[model samples]
Structure formats: C-alpha cells, structure tokens
Target: MKKLAFLVLLIVTVLSGTLVGKAIASTGFDAYSMTTHKIENGNLTNKVTDLISFTSQNIENEKNNDSKLVSINNVSDNVIDSSLSTDEEILQELSRYKDLENTYLMQPGWTSITFDQYDLLPLNSPKPLPSQYRKEFWSHFDGNQKVTEQVDYLISSETGKVPLGVFVNGELTSLWNDGQKVKKDPYTPAYDLYLVSSIQTLVESNSPLELSFKQEILANQSVSLIELRTQFSTTDKQWINIQLDKPVWGQYEKFTFNSQTGLLLKYEHYYVLDDMSLVLSSVTDNFEYSVASEAPSDVTNLIATGGK
Candidate 1:
C-alpha cells in the first residue's frame, strides 16, 4: 500500500509539472503569444471600438458644405485606349505628374467623402444612381508646393451604407462619418483639390492602377521614385502587392487601396536589402469584403459557379 501511494504521488507530481510547463510555454514572451493574449482578453477589440467611436464623432462634427454637385461636364470622358497602350506606357504617362511630398500637412475640406465596396456593380451590370456608384475625385492645389490629389467617393447627402472614414492629404485622417475633430493641422485644402483632379484624370482615362500608383508617389518616403510591383492572384481573384521600392514603410508594405472604391485589399510586400537584393516578405495580411457576393450562404454557390 505504501509503495502504491508513492507511485501515485510521483505520477501526480509529473502531471502537475507538465501542466505548469505548458502554461509557461503558452504564455512565453513571443509577439505571437502576446497577440494571442491581447485578442483573448479583448484589449485589441476595445482599441478597435475606441477607434470607431473617435471616427464617428469626427464625422459628426464635420461642417456640412452647401456646395452642389459641380458638373464634371468640362472633364473629358474619353477612356484611355488601353487596347492600344501597354502597361508600361500607361505607367510612364502617370509618372509625368508631380508627386505630393508632404500630404500629412494637407488641410481638411468642408465636404466629406466616403466609399462603399458593396456598391460595386459588375462591369456588365446596369448603371446605378450616382450615390450607388463608387467614384473617386481629384483636386489640384498650388501652395508652397504643387500637389495633385484624389479622394475615394463623396456622397451629396448622407447614406446609411457609407463607410466611416475621411482622407486628408490622400491619407486616411479620420474614421468618424459625422466628421468630428480627430486631428487638426496646417490643413491644405488646395492639396485635397489637386488630388481630386488627379483621380478624375486617371479614372476618365481608364487607368485605375495608375491612379493608385500616383497616390503611392504622393505618400512615398524616399529620395528616389518608388518602383511599383503589382500581381494578380487567379486563385484568389484579387490583386496583390509584390513590392514597393519606397524607403519608408507604409501601413502595409505591400497592400494598397482599391482604385475603384478605395477599399483595402490583399497585397504582398517585397523587401529589398542592400538596395539591389529583393525578397517577398509577406502576402495578404488583411482580406477585404468579397470582391463578389456578400451572403454567407451565397459564398458556396458563388465558389461553385467560379465566382470569387
């Protein structure tokens, strides 16, 4: 009986040690472990919530401008003959535009703009209302520097479906839809206007990717012009970022906004070491709303039907 009790005690001790070791291993000092903890304890969730609240307040506070929808009648609607133009030629043409160096200092406009990925209609689908259509705008500015700019979409009136966010100097400035104050600035309204013009030029020309690339230049941080690397995944039916030859890191080294809706999409980042070497560092960190259907039940059917 004494021997049996000793054996049981030894087994119990071994099991306890195993459990403690596992607990330590699971809570190790690695970033992944810490991230897991943050996710579990709702710290990340709360931070996201706080960010959303801050954005909502900012959108609420934005001064509603009485400006009517100005006619784009003068703007040429001639689609760039993509059939006659090579990608290289299109990119070269886009490169001719001056890049915005310090868009972070751009001023806020009175009118608010928003984008909705869900509003996208298939290329063959019937046309929707102006509000249902996702469009970007470009505005020109002449201040201390000459800068051209673009925004994702602007609704004439409030739409419940519009995503909550604001762009200042081509970068996301606020998340609130009501337009409350999130950040103040030496805000340059002219820069925003320039961007709006640039966007119009690119879109009307049927050069969506070029439009995105120009935005990259305005947002680039480097001595030399950044080299753009683009790729499309047939498996995923999404465009992926392969590389960006910029000096400073962006929010995602590879991913960028959708040219049509300004929505975030899966992108890859390529890292170059020693100025000449290259490597694909990461791919598709975030997935946006489906480029196709929305309903969960529809996903299976869509996939079976070869729709992404």
Candidate 2:
C-alpha cells in the first residue's frame, strides 16, 4: 500500500444566509467535531455537531473520550464497490462543461435558476429570520462570436425583496438599489450562483476541489447515490445524481448534472436535526432552458453608459 501525501480537504461553504462546511481531517479520515455557530444580527447561535464515522467497510458511530470517532482504515486504497461509479468517472463527466464560454456561445441558451432556502433549525425552534428565502437568477448567452453573457439576480431577505444587480460578461455592469446606474466591476460570485456555473466553477477552480472530493470519497465508506436518472418532462435527457451523506458539518448534499452536457441541473443541501430528521436548507434548480436573444435592458443600458 502506498502512503499518499496528505492533501487539503475541500470545504464548499454556502453563505446563503447561512454558513456550513466545517470539517477537520487527518490523513485518510475526516473527523468533524465542535460547535457550529451561526451569526445573525451580531448574535451567535450554536448547534452541537453530530459525530459520523466512515470506515472502509461501513459508516458507524463511536463515542470515546467525549468525542465522536470517524475512522477510515487503509482508505487510501479502498475502491468503492463496482456497483457505484468511481470518482474518476464523475470527474470525466464534469469535465465536459469546463469550457463554459465556448459551450454557451456554440449552443446559446438561457436558464432560469431558483434557489430556495428553508429553515435549518428544528420545527419547534423560534425563527429569528424568514422561514424561507428565495433567490433567482436569469442567465442569457448569445451564440455570437463575442460570446456575450449576462446574468440578472434577485434576492429575498428579511429586509424585503430587491434586485441584487446584473452581471454582463462576468462584470457587475448594472445596479438599481445602490443607485450606481452603471458600474463595471469584476464579478466573482459563488460557484453555486447558477446551475451551469456551479459545475463549471468546480471544474475550473484552481483549488483541489476535485482531488479533495475524490480523496474524501475514496477515503470513506459507501456513498448515498451515484447513478443516472431520467429527468422529468424530458424523456430524452438523462441526469447524473451524486449524493454525499454526512460529508461535512453533518450536511447531506445531492448534485444533479446533465449527463450529456455535464452542466449542473440542481444542487441540494440538507441539515440534520437532533432527532436525525433532515431539513432542506438550500437548493438551486435549473428547470428551464431556451434560446437566448438580444441583451436585456439592464445589460444594454449598462453598455450604453460607456461600460465598454
């Protein structure tokens, strides 16, 4: 057995009104313990971390020395059973969408992405924030030679609903609430901002997200789901589903990708409760797609203001 050099753990943090991904790892195993705090309005809310142990054979719970133990014995060489697709296969599928600028320009389509956030706490807990928060984005791409792209964002929060702004060609080109009229600042939003972008960013990231994810998967027990399923309303389209159980911060995540284009279709995160019940925390769904047309008023007006 070869002792692989320890690589950094990839923690994908979601800051959509909540924070997650708090995992500490040694060589081949990840042991997550400690308090996860949520800061809201200058106040802190604490939640006890659940102990989940992943082994080469299976995942179990071990309570010792007032700490939870998640052990992975000789996991560096462990191969997931033949029934499940290997991490390499998943990465190969993901690599297909790496060239976003080219893919969008060649095929040119628009997608409506809706992100829904639900109550993370238990049902009986007093809610300090809105029970549900909805954020939306519209990404348009013209198949022109210039590869024009524009994204519009709207967010609903405790203060109320408002249009976040617009990003044209990866630049914040427009603003309404801020009264900026025209601003062309480089925009580097979260990977999960859009469905296709989520996949593209993961593949294009300079960080070892793919390697760390593969190491984490191969360094553990069985995964929840890794298979292809037919998408609803589209019999010809197939989607690949990958679900990670208790990967980090006791969060369960499911990722759906277009089997053909490798573009992400959905990403879902669930919070585990004391009673072991799961609460959906956030989800981004790419439900609709259509051919792109002329630029929206936001993008056009921003360019008209000399944001050339």
Candidate 3:
C-alpha cells in the first residue's frame, strides 16, 4: 500500500511540473514563451532567407519601361507655322493644345512629365478617389510559438482621411483619428499600429506602390487613378510625410478626418528627410474586438441581470 501511494505521488509530481512549466512559458510578453528558440540558428530560417533574397533579386531585374520626359522635346512640335495668325487665333490654338495636354497627363502608362506642363493645368482638377472603407487582415509568428493576428481599417472621405479603427483580439482599445472606437487587444499596441498603417497606406495611394506584377495591370487600367498607397517618414498632429520616388508620381497627404462621424480622408503635402531613405519607423497599435454576442456567457448574464 505504501509503495502504491509513493508511485501515485511520483506521477502527480511529474504532471504538476509539466503544467507549471507550460504556464510559465505562456505568461510572458504577448503571451509568448520567453525562452523559445529563435530562427537565427534554425535550418528553416536559412531556407526562408534564401527564398526571400531570390525573390527580391528577380523583382529588381524587371526593368521599368516608362519613358521619362525631362525637357521640351520639340519646340515647334505643336506650333502652327502661320505668321499671319491674329491674337484670337493664337489664343484659340493655345486652348486647343491645353486640352490635349490634359488628355496626355491622364493617359495610361504615363509616369512623369515636365513640371511646367503640370502647372499649366487648373489646380482644382479632380484627382483619384478612394473607396469608403478598406480592411486588411494579417497573421505571422512572432519568433515564439504563438501566432499574432491583426485587423486594420482605413476609413476615408471626400475631404480628409485617417485610420478609423483596428482589431487585435476582440476588445475595444485605442481611438486615434477621431473618437472612433478601435477594438483590439491591450497588450499588443505596437502590432496593431503596424497593421493599421500598412493597410491605410495601401488604401490611400493614387497608384500601386508595392512593386509587383499587379502594378502593371493597375497602370493599364483607367480606374488605377483611384488606387491608394501611403508611406510614413514622420508623424504630427496635422501633417504626415509619405515617401515617394518622384514628386510628380503622387502627393503625400496628412491623415485627416471628420470629428463627428470620423469619416474624412484627404492627403496634404509633407516633407521628407534629406537622407532620402525610404524606410519609415513607426510603432504598432495592437488590439482586438468582440461583438456583444461574442462576449463571455458570464458577462452577458451579468448584463442581463443588471438590466432587471
């Protein structure tokens, strides 16, 4: 009988040790194990690195065929060599060419043009527009065994634009653009920010920003004008600096929104640093959201009882 009791105790002790170890491993930052193995020394890490490097090299090799207009190609290309023309006739001719110039500016596959030509057009000309709202979901392993999930939304309007909300794990957390509630996990704010910014930038761009085969299709399509992309160099109360390869390619606008419904999406000019690097360092806003129906039964029961 004593031997049997000792064996049972030994079994219980072993199980307890296992349980305790698991609990400790899962209690650290972001609910990930603190002592988990890193990819730096793993075989899979080397394979992933090689694959990424190969893909990047192939992308760089794809040459851009868009012609760049640097200066006046032909001074008399559009000129009518009529010395007898009156002032009215000259003005009429100029107006006709101005319309053609605007058409060329809006043509497909047109990447860059002279600044003088762009300035000759009216300032209030309508540019590309974005959809009402855009949502994106991303998941990745954070070095640890745990996988992180993020959901971001870009809410835009006719006059201003801003990041409306985010969801990390079914909970309401930070509200940035206006007082719109962004539901997310409280523990992973940085992760939320990264996902939100990435989606917002993509949805706000006038053209495809990411270098991919999709950009070719976008360039060919007339509706490509409405496509949105964004990058961050700096952040401020009323302004944001979005990086671009060329100024004429697109305009970087500050993220703005309506105070009431939190539905404004507009872009304004901002400056880039002199260093000219494309990377933008920013924090992540990580969180999650849950609908009332999705809440715990105990919480719902409490709410129902309190209403009585």
Candidate 4:
C-alpha cells in the first residue's frame, strides 16, 4: 500500500496538470518514501541513482516497468498546410474544437481504450497492463478518480436534466430517476485516445503557441498530426536554461486526424524522462455521429444511491 501510494505520488510530480496519461517519474528527483515528494515553487528536481539502486524487490512487483521505443520523424512531406501564423490565425485554428461533447455525451456507441504506464522505481521490469477500460462518460472519471457518473444520458435540451444510472460489472446496480437536475454541468477529464482535449486546452488558454506539422504511419495507415508546444523561456527570469531533448519529464498529445474532415481519428499521448516512460494509446474503433441514445427502458426498481 505504501508503494502504491508512493507510485502515485511519484507520477504526480510529472502530471502537474492534464488527464490523459498518469504514470512514470522524471529522472531528477529523490523519494525517501511514497509519502513525500520534494518540490519547490511548483517545480521538482531529480537525482534518482540511490532510489533505483536501493529500492526493494518487493516493491518492484507492483510497478509496471514496460518500455516502448518512441520517436518522431519529419515525415511532413505532404502536410495539409493550415498556415496558422498570426494570433487570429491561431485562434481560428483552435476554434475548431468549440463544442465537442465529452466521450459519454458522444452518440450511444461503445469505445475501448487501454491506458498503460511505466517508470523506474524500487524494482524495474516491464509489467503487464491492467484491465483495458471502456469509457461510457458517466461511469468514467472526473480528474482525481471521482466525479459525476451516469445511468444513461437522455437529456432534455429544454429541461436541462439528464437520466442517471449506475452499473457494477455489466449489471445494473441502481439508477437515478429520470430528469435529475445538474446545477452546473460536471466537467470531464480528457481520457480519450485521440487527445482531442489537448487542442481544447490550448484553445482555452488563449496563449500564443508554436506548431509544426508531421505525418506518420500509425497502425499501418499514414496519419497527420501537428505538434503544438508551450516551451519555458530561459531568457525569462522565471525559467532556467535546460535542453529540450533532456526534458525533466515531457508529455505530448499527438492527435491523429482524418485530414480531409479535420476530425480526430486516434489519440496517442507519450511522456518520457531519463528512466521512465508512459503511453496512452486510444482510437475510436467506430463512431456513429448520427446516432442518439435514450434512457434504458429495462432499468430495475433500485434507484442509484450515490454517484461513486
């Protein structure tokens, strides 16, 4: 239990913010134990030789130490140039993600995603992935593992309420009566494979960004994606000089798109440091944009007590 908590604290250092990939530790920090992480002014430093050499094998059993070779090549030979230079152009480029509903709010189709993580700790060997997850929005998470869940969404655009229910292992455990009120709509974390929300993050930040386009073969077919970067400036008093290649820990959201329609095809996010790396690979196996879902007619008499 201490190791698990330590592992969680270890990764939290890198995932300061963001909801996609949630595992791995940067190279330059020391962990005396799982309970404490050394941080100053929201930034952490690293020098992990001792922990790697001294951690116990008992703890290694719990850590997933898998490693996959990750790289990016130019392949921009045929990028569909969306020349977004000026702020107005950037905003125009970002405006594309205006109202993409959350994964659950998506039409009533099913999605399967496998989220796996790796890192260097007391014991380091690639471990098997945990159970693959199928996210149905309402049953999914709110950033830190708890949030509003659903029964089945049959919202009334006019009444501003939605159908809510609960299930446990493919069985309906309970459900909320239809038309339950939601004071302020619950916000969802970006857990999709396509990393579409990364675009939303940049769009909402309203910050000036720099990007480079590329095309790479993903699962056989060529994919087009753009790298939008938010770099720390060394010249600024707030940031110190550091090489980009040796990022303490870097997380990237590589959104593969259907170039012609500019819609997300797959979500691939990668994070890496000197000793650990993490990946969240996802794709909508199939999406039915025109389909709409209604409340399940066969719900049991038991009403869902709490949205756990």
lDDT of each: 0.24, 0.32, 0.22, 0.31
lDDT tens digits, residue span 141-215, model 3 = 233323233222233344343322223343322223223332333222221112223333333443234211001
Ranking by TM-score: 2, 4, 1, 3
User: Where does candidate 4 stray beyond 4 Å?
Assistant: 1-78, 85-88, 99-132, 138-209, 213-224, 231-249, 259-262, 272-291, 295-308
| Candidate 2 runs further than 4 Å off | 1-84, 97-134, 140-151, 155-162, 168-251, 271-280, 296-299, 302-308
Q: Which ten residues in a row have the lowest lDDT in candidate 3?
A: 113-122
In candidate 4, position 282 carries an lDDT of: 22
Query: What's the TM for model 3?
Result: 0.17
lDDT of 2 by residue, 166-209 (tens): 45543443333332333333322223112233333434543222
Residue 188, candidate 1: Cα error in Å is 8.1
Write the number of the candidate with greater TM-score, choosing between 1 and 4. 4
Model 4, 28-50: lDDT tens digits are 11111111112223321323333
Return the TM-score for candidate 2, rounded to 2 decimals. 0.41
- What TM-score would each prediction reach against the true structure? 0.21, 0.41, 0.17, 0.38
Between candidates 2 and 3, the one scoring higher on lDDT is 2
Ranking by lDDT: 2, 4, 1, 3
